[model samples]
Target: MDGQWVEVADRVLVRRHAELDLSAGLVVGDGGCLVVDTRGDERQGAELAAEVRRITRAPWTVVITHSHFDHSFGTRSFLECPVWAHEDCRADLAENGAAARDTWARWYRERGDDGIADDIAATEIVLPDRLVTGVAELSVGGRRVVLSHFGPGHSGNDLVVHVPDAGVVFAGDLVENGAPPDYEDAHPLGWPPALDGLLGLLGPGDGTVVPGHGDPVDRGFVVAQRAEIAAVAELCREVAAGRMGLEEAVQLSPYPRETTVTALGRPLDGPPPAPGGREIMRARSWGCPG
Candidate 1:
């Protein structure tokens, strides 16, 4: 609805913003508090930090769900505390963080959003200081929270934050609600399995799932989205192996054409490899079998 604290469970709150319809989370533990994501830039991060202060005076530890500019860029405002993320997250930021920021900054500027552009330009990239390759147990105010990098999916660095005590899962961009799945940097094949791991961790029954965007959802929602993801994965393999044509695959995909194209273009953990000469010529001169 708005970027206010909407409690999903005990001591767990998801703040949904209207800007990108993105959601960040706050978990208050007796020892300290855990901020699921920082936001897009310094200004937004400061605003979130202020709101968090109103809820609890506890010191905060940040768990970045991914390296995306929106979910991870707003860490400067929380420098007094530790920031955690998947180990690959650090590498992803180090490799492409500046370019990513510049890209968004220019996009906003071209759209006449100078203020947002300037804010993004001014926000220094804050890479996660603590890294987690596997399940890393943490304690915030005596309560336990687990951070796990299920596998390469939304990105090579997607991390899911689980609060077993609160029975809530902060499923970064792994499970989007307000929008279709973002496939710009996704591993379509691996995405489904990663989601499966999250499902396994949640282990059935009723529980809240705080997606990276939109309002928090339930287990059934994740299940349905996972099924769509599974369809995409199957289509990817079929298309890659030439058993399914791009246009036909697009027609059959669970998402829109553009989203399906982007998702199918990427294979596993990185960008699509350069097409061969024949492939390039075929695309430019004549259409391929469809």
Candidate 2:
């Protein structure tokens, strides 16, 4: 096993990986099961799949939170089962996955991590067969799981998974725990409202949130992060309107300087580019360094 899974709620478990501090989730139900985000590459995916087997032998369905390599590349190992994600995710993978593999492989190779580099090089991208445009529900065994796409935020196709029975929401990369939000492919203006939709999932109850990376957080943690992100969005707006300088935005940002700089460079208006329209490769310096 890569690591011991923490049961955040009844039948809801989150497995944390040390490579990127990535978190993958499992929700076991009476009849079937739901897997949230496979690991980085095929080998990592295999390890996670083995972990899932240890938990329950029930059939599983996969949901990709976004098309980032850490969240999506390992999906091939869990194949032969339906893979679900935002509609744009399929397009993102189809358009940029190969480029991501090549770029990240080169990045790891330069860092003398040839094993991972080769693993990335060898990964055969698998597009999500089942796509969600807005929201969709799944019946995993007897429990209900909701997959919702609340516009663009972290990426053009960020997917949020809500397990209503357990009061758990896997918020993907929309909400970061240990680090600042990644703005490499983020929609700075749209991120805050997107989190608003994510917060809506918690309703009035105290629910557990398993972020794409780091430990599970409470609703309050997300609330604070949302404010931070909204602040960044405001900073982006100011810079766009000549009300604040880029340097000032960086200085005032809640995130680190480099992250703030990246956020400032992204579009301040409009949504993230649709798949095949424009693609931003994962920068080595940004979140989830490969």
Candidate 1: clashing pairs of residues: 30-141, 31-141, 32-141
Off by over 4 Å in 2: 270-290
> Where's the lowest-lDDT run of ten residues in candidate 2?
276-285
Model 1 / residue 50 / CA error / Å? 0.6
Indicate which candidate wins on lDDT.
2
lDDT string, candidate 1, 97-168, tens digits: 887778767766776778888998998988888999988999989988999888888877899999998889
lDDT computed for candidate 1: 0.83
> What 10-residue stretch in candidate 1 is worst by lDDT?
275-284
Compute the lDDT of residue 148 as modeled in candidate 1: 88
TM-score list, all predictions: 0.92, 0.93
Model 1: residues >4 Å from true position, as ranges?
268-290
